[model samples]
Target chain A: MSLEVKELFKKYGDKVVVDNVSFSMPGPGVYALLGTNGAGKTTSIRMILGMLEKDGGSVTWEGKPLNFDTCNIGYLAEERGLYPKYSLMDQLRYFGELRGVDRKTVDERIKYWAERLAVEEYIYQKKGKKQQSPDQLSKGNQQKIQFLIAMISDPQLLVLDEPFSGLDPVNTDLLKGLVREQIAAGKYIIMSSHQMEAVEEFCTDITILHRSKVVVSGNLNEIKKASGRVNLRLKVEHDISSFIRDAGVELITEKEYEYVLKVTGDDQANGLLKSLIAAGIPIVKFDLSELSLHEIFVNAVGDEAKEVQE
Target chain B: MNDAENIYSIRGIEKVFLFTVRQTFKNRGYLLSFILFVLVFTLMGPIQYASSQAGRGAAEKSMSKDVEISDVENVFVCDQTGILDESVSDLGSVDGNVSFVSDESVVSDSLGKNDIVIVIKTNETGFIINGIISDSSDISNDTLDVVTSELQSIFDDTRMKKSGISESDIELIYSGVSVDDPVKESDLYVNKDGGKGKENKIQSGSYGLYMLGFAMVVFIVISMSSSYIITSVTEEKQSKLVETLLVSVRPMALLMGKVVGMMSYVVLVIICGAIGSTLSSYLMERFLGIDKSNYGGSSYDFSIFTSFGIVNTLFLVLSILLAFLLFGMVSGLFGSTCNKTEDIQVATGNVMTVAMVGYFSAMVIGFMDNDTVNLLAALIPPFSFFTAPVAFLGGRISGVILAVAYVIQLVVIVIVLRVSAKVYRLLLLNGNTVPGIKSVLESVKGA
Candidate 1:
């Protein structure tokens, strides 16, 4: 069973928001939807989830039209919220109920997630004292609650849209661990984020949107390989700026004795390494790898105006 | 089994319903308002009642005082024609305090102490009786009427005896007669030809029910339900919680559940207010001797059902239910288009205006009892709900008209639900304000 969104399209009057957007998730894994602001990543995801009316396209799960009735879908929206004046447990229970979980199950799930998300204190609160509303909790703690709501249903498919927004590193890592566990349990996840490093760490497949169009998409490694292995990082005890220059490689950055160079191919990188050794500079670290997800994203969607004009 | 297969279940609807109602009461602002309402009505009932009783009591007391004063005052009778010579001896039979006087001076002197003077003179065909008393005295007109009527009856009897009229004939002439009415005004006309035992008399309790019912709808729909629905929807929209919610529940299910939930909360409030007011009035009357039945403006009698009849009572209940549903759903539609809490009023302002128009129009027409206004108001969707009760109670509308109005509302509700579903689907996921009805309609059509 897989999720397939084909030829999806959306528009507002003459302004097209998502044009012919297509992607497929063959099985349980994270599919990263990477894009700059207003690239229609959210719009496409909404259409795929059947939350929005599409201009044209079909979204299917296992060869049948996909809908809330056909598959259990958990969504962590870009703009997260809990009723500011309500208890955290109440809202979580409500969300669970929406997903067809009974009260007993909802209560159980709330307890489990509250403990896992480390929000048990807020949920249980003090017996006599008034329970805290969402607004009373710290921004990070609220984000944790939001995550707990999305996972309370234990859905088979999860869509996280900027799930880790506005979180400190510790909280981010905490949520990331939970997300990794879901994937291990065979949850099909579609994630959209500005944090490319996080995407690179989790997403096996990716679709990079640039101005309502897919500029790059496919297996993450394949897309990175397509971007080419033209970037190199090196560290040495002595200065290697002169060797990099003589080897005809473009010096991108230098800090003390360390240097980053851009190369056309492996030949240039090898020559640079050889020149550095010939110069009697002790090679501390040498690495040749494909483009980082960040670099690839920048390359794909960097020139927004140019891409739109094209 | 996938989650989607069981998504159409009632468990979600039930949860949302319970959550919303609990939240409404749990909200301190709402709870305070409800408490204030109960106190005001409960106290108002007995206070108004007591004042009315006091006024009636004062009038009754004044009447008894005048009777007592009249009983003590001496009645000086001056007989000029001598037709009352025999009757003068028995004047005490007429009133124990009366005395016959032949001198005019005695009659004139008795006026100083608010005493009465009666002079009898012969007219061409009968006796003339004149009564004189102090103008400033607090004498009741009832005493004077009884005195004049009694003298006239005596003169008639004396003349008949002198004319040799038969006693049976005199008895026949003075006997009281009355005609029994078989057809009531309401049964004849308001029932529209459904004669015999089909009277739609507006009982005393019906008015109280109408007043209570109208106030409940206005308060619940305008102040509580509309605000609650608008705020809830706006909050969800602004916070984008709806995006996740829609995945599990349909827009219709979510909205209608809220409508029912908020309505139940309002009903609970109304019931509480009624019980509280009743209990307060009872406690006041029982413990404090307030005599609420005499003082209370309208008795809090539950006999409205027996008075209004089963069919009419059903109409009343249905009208209220339909009104709440129509207004509640309208508020929901408007609420969905809003993107922020502050924008809620702006989004639902026109809808509220429409509701308020119906409410105020009903209030005016309720007292006016205008057939045209009542019929028109009853035909309009929401206005029909508010005005039908007034029209029915005022006898401005017939049974047929009432039924028609109810049917119109039912039809309007179905259509509104359909259109609302479209608007809800579009606006729930929309990131920006819908701006106006034109765009919303366009979106609904497009969807």
Candidate 2:
């Protein structure tokens, strides 16, 4: 099944919050919605989910108008919360029921997710005993419960906004495993997060929003490839600052026996390597890597700001 | 994956409705408030009855002391006609404390110490009778007339005896002379036109029912259901859960689910209150023998509820239920618009003020019994919710008027619900304070 969002637009008064935000995933995969604070990522997601009214454009799933009634979808909002005074089990069941999940199935899914997410101790209650409320659980555990609720329906289309914002490393990995599992199961997913490494780990296609506008978008690898390989890492027994300077390559960093250099392409890296080898530098390691998603995000957002300033 | 494969089965609104009701009952504060209200309402009738009874008893005691009808018994008579002794002795039914003086010279002296003195003297026409009473005696005119009638009867008897007439003839003449079918005096306050006028006085028990009904509306519609709706909506909004839930259910469905669910909770509370109070009051009167009448010193006729016909009772129940639904939906809108807990309070507080106006106006007009005011209050949308029942119960308005008022209320509620659905959608994702009144008004206008 395909999920297509075309030219979505939203505005608050005269200030546009999401403008011409467009993308599509023809098959099950992770699509990342990346942006800075107030960058309209959340607004775009809301519009896509039909939670917020779109000023312009349409979102369709499998050639039909995308809506709650038309499609089964799950959403994890960035500002995470639960009924703090209510039982975790109850809230989960309620969320499931809202998504049209039957009670028996919801209960089974609750048990499954609780065990999978390692929150069984907090969720299950003894017979004739009062269940624990959300307030009784820690913040991280509450987030686990929130995740459990979001995934309880086994939705085909899952939208997560900052799904791991306040999670610890172990819990984050636990959630990440479930997300990967869903992807493997051929479930269409869209994730928005500030963690670039996490997005890069799973997301294949991405749209980066900056100041309510799309700055960089399309295939993750293609965007990086177009930006080019700009960095090289070298570790040697001796300091290579002079050889790097001789090669006319800009040294990005030098600490102890390691050197990081900026280069234009493979030719410049090969020329630097030749200069280094001829100089009889005992090179322990030489590695050339493309710009990280973090660098690419910062550069794209920064370049947009510069353009605006100009 | 095919489109059908992506579809997940969802439970109907029954699940949400059940969950909401269970949660409300689970809330200790709501439970406590409900119980407290029931006990208070149950005891209201007995307490009011006792106080009125006490007042009635005290009034009867004071009334007996205020009138001195027995004081006129100390009357003295001087009969110089010589036939008065026989004539007066023949009148066996005269209850006056009359004593004859052997000496006429002592009669005037007797008047100073006694209440009054009467002298009967034989004359050519018939007999001359004169009465002397002290100005300070304070005898009422009715008491004086009684004494005068007895003396005149004695004179007529004396004349009839001299004319050889019998007592039977006198009885026949007097019996026929009396006016038949005397017109009873009535005040202007009475229902002079015999129209469907307001009952000038309602039975105490009926008044109590009116009060109970009014309080029920206030508690269910304003206090309990509104607060529940607002809190539930705001809680979902705060947690940002509404967005996710919206994707699973339509905005209208979600809103209606929440509202209908909370309304069920409210109706349960009201029913519990009604049952608890009724059961407690019954047990108190039946087993405990606490004597509800003793507590409520005055005697009351049957309860107003008892007098109501099936249709009236049905109307009462339906109107209140509709009114509550309307209130729940409107309050849901308020909660949806708010961004924080305090904002919910402020927003609902405005609604409460408006509801309070209707509540108090119903009460004031209920007692005033002014036709214009009652009609106006009963026909208004929400105020009609309170006043129409009261007017119907008190006989101030007809059934047709009440039905029309309910129709108006239904129309207003339908309109509000439609507008609220739109507002609910607009404000669900909005995290900012939705510019309260103006924003909703504008949205409604746009719709």
Give the candidate number with the greatest lDDT: 1
TM-score (chain B) of candidate 2 = 0.61
Tens digit per residue, CA lDDT, model 2, B35-71: 7767766766566656666787899877545443455
In model 2, the Cα lDDT at residue B379 comes to 94
Interface DockQ per candidate? 0.44, 0.37
Q: Which candidate leads in DockQ?
A: 1
lDDT of 2 by residue, A1-310 (tens): 8998888887766788888988999999999999887889887887788766677888899889787676778788777778878777777888888777888999999989888999997888878887677777788887888778778888889898888878899989988999999999999999998888988999999998998889898999998888788789989998777778877899877888888888988889999889878878778989988988888888889865344334
Worst 10 residues of 1 chain A by lDDT: A301-310
* Model 2 chain B poorest ten-residue lDDT run: B1-10
